[model samples]
Target chain A: MTAVAAFAWSVLQDALHRKVFYAILAFSLLLMLLIPMLPSASVGVQVDLLREAALGLTSIMAFLLAVIMASTIIPGELGRRTLYNTLSRPVRRWQYYLGKFIGIMAVVAIALLVSLVVLLILVGAKFGTFNPGLAKAIFTIFLEAMVLASVAMLASVYLSPLVCILLAGLFYVACHVKGDFLYRAMTDSTNHALLRGLSGFLYYILPNLERMNINETIAHSERVFRVGAGELVLLSAIALVFSAIFIALGAYLFERRDL
Target chain B: MEAVLSVEELHKAYRTRLGGPRRQALSGLSFTVPRNSVVGLLGPNGAGKTTTLKCVMGLVRPDAGKVSLFGRDGDAVEARRRVGFLPEQPYFDLYLTPRKLLHYYGRLSGMGASSARSRISYLLNLVGMEDDADLTMDKFSKGMLQRIGLAQALLAEPELLILDEPSSGLDPLGKLEMRDVLKSLGTGGTTILLSSHQLSEIEEICDRVIIIHRGREVASGRLDELLEEKGDCEVLLAEPAPGATSGLPSSASWAEDSGGKRLTVSREELSAALTALIESGASIAEVRSRRLSLEEFFVRRIGKTGWEVEE
Candidate 1:
């Protein structure tokens, strides 16, 4: 556990030194601050618009931070020969893998927290009302980012960062679309049998990432259906199970890999 | 003597590319580093020296055979806890200060915070980087980085220190300092296995050597014993007498240096060469069996042909 914490702390230190980390973070905050400029349908929907846009920007910030950090950390360390120093220590491969994953999430979580605070201030200052409900949407965004980061990290073990990012992007799109597009493709009679079979297989295997997206509902004050603690627990469970599978597979491959 | 590390019939092959032909890096290569011995791992380019070290360090998995450290499996975390390694041209995050970097490694090695702080300070001074310990390594020279690398390797005061090209990137003085440090460590009972192309460095610091050619052990033994086995003799003369070579055995060769004119002869021609030198009025100052230098021994064992092949 000490070794794991050391590795995790090292990753955070490494990230803190990189310029890209700050750039992504600053850019996300700057954009979120500009959410008031976006046109809205009416004066009544203006607050909802601000919350929705800010949360949307926050999700992008979280995902970008998560995937980019995950994709680059392993490959960067390996290319720089720094992994030789770390892994040569008396630590297990799983510890290094898990530590790095946790570090990436930490960075993403930090970014999300900053965005939440900024959005909260913006809501209070503009509408003269406290909207702590934004925290709930930020939590779900964090869970989705967790899944994205794990997938990217798994790909990063064997693929280059660019390829890992692209693959994760494709995964995000496919998983998000699967809940609707894949289900329809599986049942649409116009599609070929093989296509339907493939869609059905993918639908069953891929996590429903869109289920974690509640920005619109939360931004509009959750009037239609309240997101209770039970629902949040279920989302957390889904993200953990999927992330665990990818992380386990990555660590197994990394254990057998030659540094 | 107890062996701190032993490898047996280790084999490793790396694919050049996906589905490409595998290049053999190690083929049934085996050796052992006895406790408290400074053993040099000498080999030509691409002779699997790095691969062997990587295998022992568990950075690269061997396809066959076993590596044992302290009579236990080399891959065991507990066994590795007692070992420290400096890879060939070790690198680290440039933004980290030498102190911070050592602290991180010390933590990974499971050192207590206070012990690690004291150890880091001692290592920084040992590597002559104490003044620069607080600065980021971004502007450090290659030699400075090498020193930091060595410092990190010694951070835990490990029992077995495995270094690949430990003197690399150091200036002559730095190299000498590194040699002294390693020599002192060996005297203090650290089992070191170092791989280096600098044969002279190995010759000076190592008591034994393992020379590999094309991924197989070509020779291995005590340095003095290996050199003495050639049975060559050298006779030092008191003066540079040009006539010292007159009527000497055909096998005897003469050369003049600052000390005097010397004659080197095979064991069979030693008496005849000495008699010839006496008849020529050459004043003999000393006579002794010749010992081959590490370079000469390496060349003789590996052969010119083995030297020519890059791999």
Candidate 2:
């Protein structure tokens, strides 16, 4: 456990020093700050639109942070040959793998926290009100990003960073639309039997990431349907389970790999 | 005597690329490091020295045999706890200072904060990096990094140290300092297994050597014993008298001179050669069995044709 924590701390320190991490954070905050200048739909719903836009920007920021860090950390260490120092110690491969994953999560968490504060200040200065419920949406965004990062990290153990990013992106899109597009494809008689079978198989295997996108709901002050505490807990559990599975499999493969 | 580390019949093969044929890196390699002794692993390029060290450290798995550290399986965590390793040309994160990096490794090695601090201080001073301990490694030279690598490997005060090319990238002065450090460690009762291409360095510091060619052990013994020319004696003379050549035995042959004339003969004919020199009124200088330098011994065993062609 100490070994894992040490590696995680090293990752956190290393990530903080990188220029790319700051570049992504600054770009997203700049976009969020520019949200108020867009064309308005109505005077009453302008604040809601601004919150939705801010949340959308935040989601992109979190996803980029997670996927980029998870995809590059292991491969970068291996390429630099720094991993030989750490892995040669009295530490297990699983500890190193888990620590790196945790470190990526820590970076994502810090980035999201900073972005959330920026979003709150922007909303307060522009609209003269506080939307405390925004925390719920941000929490869901973090959960969703963890899932994405885990899957990307698993792919990173076997593929390059660019390929892992692409695969994770494809996975995100497929999983997000599974509840809607996959259902339609599975039930539509116009589709071929093999296509329907494949769709059904994918829908059953992949998580419904679309359910975790409650940005609009919380951004609009829960005017339609609110995310209750019980639902949030259930959703978090599901994401945690999936992330564990991905991490376990990734560690297993990493352990067997010759360094 | 118990061996601190032993490798028996180890074998490994690596694929050049995807779908490529496997190339043998180690073929039935075997050697052992006696407790508290410094043993050099000597080889030319592609002799599997690095592969053998990697296998001993559990970084790579051997296909055929076993490596035991302190009489336990090499891959066991408990066995590795007593070991330290420095890889060839090790790299570290540039943003970290040596102090911070050593602290991190110390924690992983299960050292408490106070003990780790003292050990880190001692090692930094020992490796001559005390002044630059707090500086980030981004601007460090190759030799500076090598020193830090040694410091990190010594952080936990391991019982056994395995170093690959420790003198690599060092200047003459730095290489001398490294030799002194390794010699002191061996005297302090730490077992060492060193892999190097520098035959002189090995000859200077190692008590014994394991010479490998084509991933197999060709010779293993005390350095002096391995370099001794069997059944051969060298005789030296100050000056030869007239007709001294006819008085010599048929087995005697003239050898090279370094400010003195020398001759090589069978060990059995040393007495006859000396008597012949005396009878001819030629002053006798020194007589001893012939011995080759480490370089000559290596070439003699490996041959003029490189191991690459043979492999």
Candidate 3:
């Protein structure tokens, strides 16, 4: 555990210490600071519009950062041959996979918090009140980022970087598509049972992004009441467990790989 | 010494759906590296030198073989704590300086913080890179990278050092220096298995050489034995005074290899003619033998020796 912590810390330092991360943070802050200008453009929509815009920025920022960092972690280590140094040790395959996952998660968490703080400062100045929905959205995006990162890493283990990125991007879109895969699976007659079975399984298995979309949280309270907190928790936990399972599978595949 | 590394009928095959049938990377490859000796794993390209090392290091698994190190099953993670490896194209984080690289490897090798710190310093100086410890790897030359690589391999002061072509990119001087490092490691009771096709380079450092041909051991023994059985002859050619190919004991059956500049004698006549040529007032200008270089041995035995290899 200590060794994993040390490894995780090293990775975290690399992610947070680089110039590019600070640049991204500053860019996110600038975007948040621009929210006040929305009030100048509209008299009544200022509160609703500014809040929705911040949530949208945070969600996109968190997800984009997740994908970008996920795409780089394994490829970057391989590019530098750093994976050899780590794997050549007495460390287990799972430790390396978990360590990298935790490291990336920590970085994403920190990035989310930073962006959240900036959003809060803007919200406080405009409305003089804190929205609980904002916190929920921020934290939910953090979980969503973990899921995306894991799926991306799973693709990375066996697939090429370009292909892994493409696949993970497809997964994100698929997760948001609601009924596309499930509906197609049910309507097909050839292997209809198998397809429907798989699709039915995925209906609850995937993150229902259309439901969790934080944009609706700020726009109207009526939309937020329909969703239960337990569902989101259960779904996020399932996603995290699935991510863990995928990482473990990826580690096994990687352990046997020649590199 | 017991075998520090043991592999019995190790095999690794990859079934790629891309094109042809599944290719076997290793089949029926078996060899034991005795402890505390500098052993050179010599083979032609694709002779499974790297495959064998990977098997020993647990990087590549054989389908039907077992690799035991320090008498422990290869699956034992602690066994790796006692093994150090230098991959053929080793890489490190470009942003990390030599100091950081050593620190990172040292940490992974199970060294404690203080021990890692002191050992890092010791290794940096041991490889003669203490001066450039602060420089990032991106700025390092190939030779420097190799030296640092060597240092990292020794970071844990492992009992077995598996180096894959450690001298490939080294200049003559670098090779000599690396040669000294491996020799000292052998002296210090570290079992070193280095793989390379540079026969001369391997010959210079390793006490015993194992030649694997087409994924099987073709020859294994001391260098002298391998060269000796090839039936080599050494000649002490004496310079007979100008125009005196005639000072020759006419009884000596010899052919002038390069228009009388040098005389070539068959293997049996080397001793007898060494005495006669000197007694005939000819001063031996050079006394050298054609000890089979590793390259020549590989070509003769593996490449064209026509040995009925089962592999």
Per-residue lDDT tens digits of candidate 2, residues A1-259?
Answer: 8988887888899888999999999999998988888988989999999999999999999999999889988889889988888888888989999999998899888998998889888889998898778989899999999999999999988799999999999999999999999999999999999999999999999999999999999988998997899989988998999999999999998887776
lDDT score, candidate 2, position B1: 66
DockQ of each: 0.92, 0.82, 0.50
Per-model lDDT: 0.91, 0.90, 0.75
lDDT of 2: 0.90
**How far off is model 3, as Cα RMSD?**
4.3
lDDT of 3 by residue, B1-311 (tens): 58888878887766656664666666677778888888899876767788788777766667788889888987688988889889886777667899987776666666788999998899889889999999877888888889988988888889999999998678889989989888888898998899986777787888888888667778887777777633435454555445334444434444455524455555566666666666656677764554666776777878553322222
Off by over 4 Å in 1: B257-259, B304-311
TM-score of each: 0.97, 0.96, 0.86
Which candidate model has the greater lDDT, 1 or 3? 1
* Model 3 DockQ class: medium
What's model 2's TM-score? 0.96
Q: Which of 2 and 3 is ahead in lDDT? A: 2
* Arranged by DockQ, best first: 1, 2, 3
lDDT (0-100) at residue A166 of candidate 1? 95
DockQ-superior candidate, 2 or 3: 2
Docking class of 2: high
> lDDT by residue for model 1 over B1-311, one digit each (tens)?
89999999998888878877788888889999999999999999989999999999999999998999999999999999999999999999999899998988988999999999999999999999999999999999999999999998898889999999999999999999999999999999999999999999999999999999778898998888987846679999876666876898888887666766678899998899989889998888999888777998998887754432223
Q: What is the interface RMSD of each candidate, in Å?
A: 0.6, 0.9, 2.0
